[model samples]
Target: MNPGLPFLPQNEPSGHEDEGEPTQTPNLEVKLAGEPALTVAEYVSLRTEILKLIELQAQLLSLALLSLGALLGVAVQQRNSNIAFVYPVLALILSFSWLNHAHAIHRCARYLVEAVEPASGGALGWERFVRQHPLPFGMLGYWGVRSVFMGSSLVATLVGWSLPHPTLLTVIAGVASSLLTLAAFVLFLVWRESSPKQLKVEGHPGSTA
Candidate 1:
């Protein structure tokens, strides 16, 4: 047992070797202020969820790019200006969903670092380590996705506007797409600015376990 992790209960020998019985260790408990205690197993489960969300983010981006390519290809081949309008709507929906996933990932990681890791007496320090040392161009993935969605929407809008004798519906779609893209960009910026910084975890007085 790590002495730093006082919340983790110490294991004792059951002395059941003569009886050929296996000993059971108690689950490590983490108590947070005004919250129920969480077991180490639960912490592991949360970490697993974060991993899944990250993978889902990549899949969503790939889906958006693939859909954009297919839609644009078909629209160009048929020379149908109306089909081009669909790309903007698709970009808005998929990009917004991806943003939501990113927000969730950020929230979960913040909780792990700020609340759970501190409660565990810094025994669970992966989150802290990550905050202290981020990769170079770590944000490029986010920016790339944002650029792709926004660019695709703008292109779709322009395609609609370029149509000879464009209808009111086409104009409306173009306007709506531009507005949605702008709104999504603003939300993403707000989220990035609101990210919490890493906090220092103080050691408990005279705590040695």
Candidate 2:
């Protein structure tokens, strides 16, 4: 059992797992204090902005990973053991990138919870959403699917670099560049999908300036 969380009551009189467990429920409320009161369209606008931030953050993560891997490979060729040393630097980069990614998702989720429901409820509810939604929180609907494309490009880059030759750096660059482009494309698509819709909001829900 994890030491940090609250100790659960014995689930059963016989000390069984299900004897006295506390049942958990999903409570969907995502409101924030600083955020403007948003309509559905405004909420979607924030979603679009957050999508761009997420896509950029993901690209940064993949590139940072690929960077560490390639630097190690290059250092290997140069007989430089310092390649191992720089891994910590790579880790720092990764941590920052991931933190940014998480922040972006949190921003989007905050709006969804707060915009849809005025009250954000309690800590448990926030924790529940965080766990269930994980990284990208695909509830952004179609935009979340873009992760697949990004993941694919990153994998391709890594595979190309895994070859047993120095020339494979080209492939690695290709992979990183491709993922970067995909990230750009995701942002473009999000803005494209959202901006026009924002314009045509004659009596529509969530329309915004």
Candidate 3:
């Protein structure tokens, strides 16, 4: 046994043992190769932040849906389609905010998988496992939420068109809103579909952990 590995038992030669035989101890240090530089505490902090962002993402989506319903209700009650214009602008802002949160979440998760897990000797492998085995209907749920926003924007455009004398500004705004919403949805899909290996290479911006 090596003196450096105190826990390992020392080997003693017996009468039947060959004189040329050598005792062997496991090379535990090899496991440390290619390990990341992050500390355990940093990994924990990053994970906590990611959990909070997920909760925030859900809340933002709820708010977007509720706001849409309320705006549509008021437009219908007043018989004024002009109010529908507000939904697109509001939805655009909300969608951008949602995307920000989503991007941050993705960045952090990628960091955890590429950096922290290796350092911890596979003890922290949840992120890596998730990447390998994604949940069913995950993309479907993503598209569903985006569809709700896009569909509502289209409805708002139709409402604007229903007016007896729709102004050019209203028509332009409605069209722009629809286009912007569709663009946002497509951008989100592209970001999500990007390879994790590419993200790791790019590294996260403004990430302290």
Candidate 4:
């Protein structure tokens, strides 16, 4: 027998050679092709601030919509009392709604920017991230809604001034209100329809299956 080889005197080895040892995995390093930038808290805080702004604006727009609905109810009852004033009130509310929508959109855009900043030359590309956050699409929908409201309010104001007959103006206003309602419903439907479903995936290291 070779000197290097161990000679089996009589019995075979008791332990299984196949079970000598389990394989070991080498350590892996995951790196992006870029430089490190912001501190964790800073990054988180920035994202939090942006999301908070979006939430605040969303609440504000919701309040405006609610107030507009209430004012519309009051206007319907008080026909002879120059219901045109309600239009101006709603106009003011719509202004605030528009501003809030724009603000929310801006913040959502900023958050998106921060998210992709590490990737390359600051671009989010066309991805669910823009929609995934929820705020961006919400703001966009609200923004479109506020535009419709603003137009309705303006037309009501002008029609009230020109046409002294509340009867005919009432018909026009009703049509505008109906159209606005339909517009809001449709925009909501589109946004909901376009949104993608999220899937949950689970994984574990060293899993055989």
Candidate 5:
């Protein structure tokens, strides 16, 4: 008989062996004790992946913008005014896609910091990193740079050269650009409200689990 488990049965009928031994119930305290370690492991892995994704998206954003600029240079060299209109339209599409990717990364990091990190045990550095960066679309941010350059290019395309009366395509492009700019602004507000409020690190490095 186990000395510590006084509640466990000391004996069972001989025929009970064929019926399969009574199921041994797990100790709730022991199970609960093991859970935090598992949670921490999961949080660490997820946080690392989120950080990697953020870096990857940043690189992609830079590459996309650079490609867009190069496209403009080509259009200019070829004296293709139509290409100017097409470039901004394409630029806005690419920028919006990039914006979505950035927001996803932000939400993932927010979940890790706000929920997982605290529950598993504190690792505040990740939270700090996430908060400091802010949303890419916020003022003077990466998306801001992209928006300013692309938007300016778009305005220049519409006004720099005079064409005959506004064509259907020109009017459509103008309306689309305006709508996209407003949508991007709304998205920025949503992210800002939902994102972490402070950039300050919350715990000692040596105290992390």
Candidate 6:
């Protein structure tokens, strides 16, 4: 034996050693952003209100279409082809109004699907219910309503073109309708593009988590 036992090797501090610090869990604050977390009942009620709004939009569209038809019929009976331009003008207005309402309905439905359903954690089925029982009218969905209006208007315009006594007013009507339709479509595109990528759920200020 040299001195005490051979020289003992000393323990070395390793770079990978964990310092006895407490681990932290990630913040899982699942919130609806601008909107407060709503109860299941509140979600359901809001969904119902949206559905009612969609129904009202449909009813208003129907009334507008009926009025347009009546106006056309009266104009024809009175042999007033000079007022032919007025028909397209009215159609443009009605179509724009209808599309605006449709957009509102779409926004509400999207909120229900994206926010409401997710928060429900499989408890809410309002999205499915709305799909199963859609709003009244031939309106099946977003594209369906848009197509219906565009298609019907095209047919009506073509028919008007074939009418007797095509005057300057007729041409003016045709041009105005086409321009307004284009304008409305452009505006819709702008609105969709300018809309926030994230959905902001409007909620009471007190509900912020």
Model 6 misplacement above 4 A: 1-38, 128-142, 181-209
**In candidate 3, how many Å is residue 58 off?**
1.4
lDDT, candidate 3, equals 0.68
What are the models' TM-scores? 0.67, 0.38, 0.67, 0.40, 0.57, 0.55
Worst 10 residues of 3 by lDDT: 193-202
lDDT tens per residue, model 6, 65-120 = 77567756765676554344355556566666766765676677767766777777
**Candidate 1 accuracy as lDDT:** 0.67
Tens digits of per-residue lDDT for model 5, 78-193? 65544445555555555566566666776676677667777855544566555555555443564464555356445535542433324677566555655555554554455432
Write down the lDDT of every candidate, Cα atoms only. 0.67, 0.47, 0.68, 0.47, 0.57, 0.55
- Per-model tally of clashing residue pairs: 0, 9, 0, 0, 0, 0
Please tell me which model should have the higher TM-score, number 4 or number 5: 5
Pick the winner on lDDT between candidates 4 and 5: 5
Clashes of 3: 0
Error (Å) of candidate 2 at residue 193 is: 28
Residue 68 error, candidate 6, Å = 3.2
Q: Which ten residues in a row have the lowest lDDT in candidate 4?
A: 195-204
Best by lDDT: 3
Model 4 lDDT tens row, 15-62: 654677432223221233223333334445555766676677667567
lDDT of 3 by residue, 79-197 (tens): 66667767877776777777788789888988888878787877778877776655565567657766665676667666755754357776676667667667656656665533443
TM-score of 6: 0.55
